[model samples]
Target: MAFVTTFSTSLRSGEGSSICGSRPLSRPSQRKMVRIFMAQEEQLKRAEDRMKKTVETVKSNFNTVRTGRANASMLDRVVVPYYEVDTPLNQLASISIPSSTTIQIDPYDKSVLGDIERSLMEADLGMNPNSDGSVIRLIVPPLTQERRKEFVKSVKAIAEHGRVAVRNIRRDAIDKYKKAEKDGDMSKDESKTNQDLAQKLTDKYVKTIDGLASEKEKDILKV
Candidate 1:
């Protein structure tokens, strides 16, 4: 009888300390906290990745938006007349902008000299090509009023494309947040907060695109 009572007293003392464990991390409450933190971190990483992709997309589309200044992208889509085959101007020749309104192209194949010049004139860049059998030069003329208006239209189209990209990013981020909530990794309230933050980021990027468009329009309008 004495042994049984002694064993019961020892069991009670062990249970009290083991259940309370001195370190908070060893407690069930703390385990839940750690799980919540991990879930939040995962969600944050996903959101950050989405934002990065959105930024890159914005940059790429912005380049295509066109500025009044000379830029490689301005000729990125220009095709050269290569010996009966169409080729990107960049591949067929070296294009250089010696001045604000001049672009020089030196073709690798001398035989296609005339063809390159013809293609440039056909590019509708509002410039004439000056060639001397080896190299071709393009003189970018000052934009006319009607030409500026047309360029503005092109700018608007590019801006709309950027807007679509930003909206797509927002949609993807929101979908991720919803998935996190469905997986029990996030509460509804937390998901809502993250979605709102993501939307704000989207707005910022959209504004950046708009600003680029405005600057480009002003430059194109400048005489």
Candidate 2:
């Protein structure tokens, strides 16, 4: 009976040692998993930021497209040679909508009035700039059917570029995870999950670009 008790005690001690040994091994693995998760989150954040900027760029480009109405934003792309430096027209002038069909540009420096008018003429906006000494006036014309179709095509192209940019960002993020999995920094399952997330993000931004494009198309064809 004493031998039996001694054997039983030895078995219990062995079990306790085994449990304690497993704790140290598990701790390192748990910390490694946490690190991997944080790294993936950071990558996703960067991808989202880039996608947002792409969306904003699409919006800005859309603003530059002409509609039937007069919008000051249409001149957002006009650059004038001021003091031998190419400068944005908005920086050298005060642009205001005195009427729905008129865009008045009053240059802070009267010397650059001619330069602003010349830039507007060369901007391919299909409008003539009328300079009256100190200010330039632009008469916004009604867009014909053919012109409206052309503007629609332009906005569509802009949206396509934005979608491509977003997809590229997603691809880059997924590639990072693939490299991580290859290097054994993360598991295959984790890498796949991150790639799926990046795809979902890409889809969301692409939908946003489409919406913006559709809205601008409607505006152009509204006349």
Candidate 3:
């Protein structure tokens, strides 16, 4: 009888906690809440990591696209031949911008200057490369109106790829959340909340990609 009375008193105290701005939960229920929170955190972390990578890829792709000014990053995608093996152009030569319109390439080994020049022309970057057996100069021409429009299209495509990557991550996270709910780890309401959080993450990254595209387009279109 004494043990029963003690247990009843504990329940009464817990019930009154809500009036004091707190509520006591059973040990099993507390564990369940913690487990659900951890699962949601894991999903959010995965989504964030995936979205960050996508954003970086978009930035890299933008660098590969040329702007009006001479940029070393324009040569980021150029491949050069080093001893019959394909290599990045930067490895074979030191690149610098001596002027706004010219990219100067000084080969560490003089023999590769010709090969590097030929590669630049073939890359179709629309720049003429001139070499005098020592240093090579690439003159970046002003973009024609038509060329600028084409570049805008290319940047939009790259941004779209980033958005798709982020959306795929959101889809995977939501699927995992739903599966956990089905397996009885959380309630339907909890699963829905987690899914909403993942969707918000997706939306945020998509907006960032759109902003990147807008800025790049503006840069390309600006005279």
Candidate 4:
């Protein structure tokens, strides 16, 4: 198929002539360009989505780590034995943060309170559970200076993991962009531009993860 058809003769009245030493691109070429643009945009969008998910994971992890205050999400990993099968504590009971330092767990069945208490103790959350046969209470003790430092380190590690995830997404996007160039679907210049854009996006997300970790670190370090 002809990508460009030059006019060898001058225009006849209504016949359009190639303007500025250039002819209009053929329909097939225009469609191909559109497809390439769409594909590049899709890769960029996928990279952004991956970065968002990684950041969300980091945020969730920050909530799970111990703080000066009690959080319901801290018990996200707590599982109790219910009828021989391990079940999530939230599924078997209602968890409430009644105060800054207290987490209340009230079992729906009432009979499983003991099991829930046991799970809380064995979970190694560094907090003891008090059960008075009906409701279980977890009084989150104040974090020691040393423990707060430990928490800061832990949250920093999680933030690093998120940054790595964002970088991995960038790598995947660059790979797709390079393949598109190799397959003749896009030009080398297009591939390079996409790679640069992906890198910028990765840097932006990594900075966001760092900021999140820094905020959590401050919270942990605060007296």
Candidate 5:
């Protein structure tokens, strides 16, 4: 009988198929579905990890606040207004740590060297640039009491922005979870479970962000 054959196949399929033979799937079909599900789960996981890494990058950028050190991160987002185009300082020059308190920038284009210096000053990272016609030298000055407070505030703002980005990713994941539910790919209970898992993912990212920020804050506070 067809029903008997269908039941036999369903039993051999190991329970990934739909209940009552409504959408009976063979073992190979179930494995394929599992692979698809795992791929999607891995994609979401990678996205969440990216969010966390972004938070760390932002924190690193803020750590460029430098209590008393010359770090390249401080200039990461500083745009050099070159040839009417905004360019990253690193692209214009080579950044190197000559000393704990000195960062050297050797520009490929001597003409744009001035532009890079100007950009650094404009960024208000509080460093004075010294140029030797070929390489620009930045002397990392000690942080003043008032300036340290301002730097702390700036780092906190960066962390808050990271938190916002992580939350946005969480929202996007929730949307995807809902879409999966609507497509009938996931049952209501499974949808709820995935939603909870997504929230856990968000929380984990947020926690990582917080921990990274805290460590960077300590670095910035070191006198």
Candidate 6:
């Protein structure tokens, strides 16, 4: 009975050691998988961030296009020469839309009013600046059919550029993973999976850009 009990005890000890040995072996592989996943996630996040920025840029550009109504954002691109340094128009003045078709600019410093007026004139926004010494007024005229069509075309071009930028970011992200696979940092299957994810992200952002463009086009075409 004693010998039989000793044999059973040895068997249980062997089993426990085997399990412990396997734990050490698996730990490295588990850690490696975690690292790989984190790297892929980081890459995807970076790509998405860039795509979002591109969309925002397209939105900002669309805002700069003149509509029939008075929008303060239409002067977003205007730069005034303040003390020999070029500055954004919004920084130098308080712009208000008191009416549907008039943009009023009130400068804190009256001395810079003339500079602001000249800058607005040079902006070529199809509006003349009427400055009465302390303030500048821009009368946003109703856009003709031809002018509206032109603005629509411009917004379309901007949307296309944004789409192209998103696609470029996707390509760059895919290339990074492919190179990782080539360097044996990841498997081909992993690289392919990441590439597919990048494509999906691109498609989503491109769709968003299209939507923004459609909205801008409608705004420009509205009488």
How would you encode candidate 2's per-residue C-alpha lDDT over 39-96 as one tens digit per residue?
Answer: 7788999999999999999999999999999999999999999989999999999999
Please give the lDDT score at residue 130 for candidate 1. 90
As for candidate 4, its clashing pairs are: none
Q: Candidate 6's residue-wise lDDT over 1-223, tens digit each?
A: 3433453354444432233355532444544545666677789899999999999999999999988899999999999999999999999999999999999999988999989999999999999999888899999999999999999999989999999999999999999999999988888988998899999999999999999999989988887
> What is the C-alpha RMSD, rounded to one decimal, of candidate 6?
9.9
Candidate 3 clashes between residue pairs 3 or more apart in a chain or in different chains: none
Identify the runs in model 2 with alpha carbons over 4 angstroms from their true place.
1-23, 26-33
Residue 223 in model 5: lDDT: 87
Kindly report which residue stretches of model 3 are placed more than 4 angstroms away from their true locations once superposed: 1-36
Per-prediction backbone clash count = 0, 0, 0, 0, 0, 0
Model 2 clashes, total count: 0
lDDT of 3 by residue, 8-54 (tens): 45555554223236667665665455556665677778789989999
Q: How high a TM-score does candidate 6 get?
A: 0.86
User: What's the lDDT for candidate 4?
Assistant: 0.85
Off by over 4 Å in 6: 1-33
Model 1 residue 105 distance off true place after TM-score fit, in angstroms: 0.7
Candidate 1 weakest ten by summed lDDT: 11-20
User: How do all the candidates rank in terms of TM-score, highest first?
Assistant: 2, 6, 4, 3, 5, 1
TM-score (C-alpha, index-matched) for candidate 5: 0.78
Error of 4 at 3 (Å): 22
C-alpha RMSD of candidate 4: 6.5
1 versus 5: better lDDT goes to = 5
- In model 3, the number of clashes is 0
- Between the candidate structures 1 and 3, which one is better when assessed by TM-score? 3
